[model samples]
Target: MVAQDFIVDLNKPLVFQVGHLGEAYQEWVHQPIVSKEGPRFFESDFWEFLTRTVWWAVPLIWLPVVCWCISMSIRMGHSLPQISLMVVSGIFIWTLLEYTLHRFLFHIETKSYWGNTIHYLLHGCHHKHPMDGLRLVFPPTATAVLCLPFWNLVQLMSTPSITPALFGGGLLGYVIYDVTHYYLHHGQPSSEVPRNLKKYHLNHHFRIQNQGFGITSSLWDKVFGTLPQSKAAKKSR
Candidate 1:
């Protein structure tokens, strides 16, 4: 079935069919359907409802978490420069993590039935329906769940005085990543940098799927040699 014909109804439970298997799954991955209605993943209304989120919630949810971490770091007697360095380090760390996850986890290919479904729910849906405002940013609830393990990992490597600031910087980086990602999809950019970023990202979506994985900055893409070629180069070829 063509994607346009597929509709996810919140009022009803999902019933998977063989027709939605194999080739249909590949199409869903490569050429995602753009739908006016939100896609339903869970049968439980509460769980399904949590999947859809507003873009502004990224800052609203993470900014406070960042502030709390920094404030705690201050109370613990870290100097401004020390905290700044840790935070900067954290932001740097997040950029690598972002690129890694986008390139590796989000793009992993799976042929199994459940694998495709899970993949679609995680990232494929975004590719298929690029303009879905609800799915543009990671849901705060999901982000919070992920933050715990990441925070624990940071604590393992750093002192208490420095860990919060470091984690806070990482959080801030994530906020930037999400907001930048949303803007790349929905916002209009007049500046050259953002315009270039938007062009790079859209090309990743519409033209070259594997390249241009970095969203906030193309630094990782450049380092990893996955950066998309220039339009001039493509034209020449």
Candidate 2:
């Protein structure tokens, strides 16, 4: 028999109660916001293992990817510094994607008809059904669809050879971001790791909307001046 491990049933509906606020938003004001999945503590499952593997494996894989970049550079008669520059450039591209996805996609308000429809299709549904688990990451289908246009844009600026390493690095960054995001909501991060993420994200749900845009790293938000100063921020100030 399969071992039955930790089990939790919150029984609460998996969404924020609609219509509680004075203003009624056709898409959000009445729909549930959070998820109803029971909180399971430290229970290892296939999905959990997959997430952990990706979290641990991406950095390891980067070595070979870098090697491939080196091989390509040698074949193309480019210098080592040029190859390193490509990797750094890839990282920078990821930063922009991270900021854009967070600011525009995750934060899109579905108040308007088209906006509401697309918002739910993109992210509102996740807020409404946060515990669905399957929907947490950008799905493979959507990723392909979105990457094509962006790939075209990048091609305009550089040669076709750079796409693989550039896309690989950005995708690696995305894998890190998605896994970290899931863990933040469901995993127990150590106190030493920094609890600001918990508070920052919570505030996004409960308090204001203009703060804590960083998921994997807050560098973009810090650079762009969007990070809100929390009480901790205030004390430091």
Q: Write down the lDDT of every candidate, Cα atoms only.
A: 0.83, 0.56
After superposition, the stretches of candidate 1 with alpha carbons farther than 4 Å from their true spots are 1-20, 34-37
Q: Cα RMSD to native, each candidate?
A: 3.5, 9.3
lDDT leader: 1
Colliding pairs, model 1: 32-128
Candidate 2 C-alpha lDDT tens digits along 1-237: 111221213353212222121123333422444664432212456433332222334345444654664466457766667766776776678778888877877775544445544555566555555555555666544555776776576667677667655655555566667777766666776795547676566565456554667777778888888877776777986
Find the candidate with the highest TM-score and give its number: 1
Candidate 2 lDDT (Cα, 0 to 1): 0.56
Query: Could you give candidate 1's per-residue lDDT for residues 59-170 as a string of tens digits?
Result: 9888998999998999999889988998899999999999999999999876666776777777877887788888889988889889999999889979988899999999
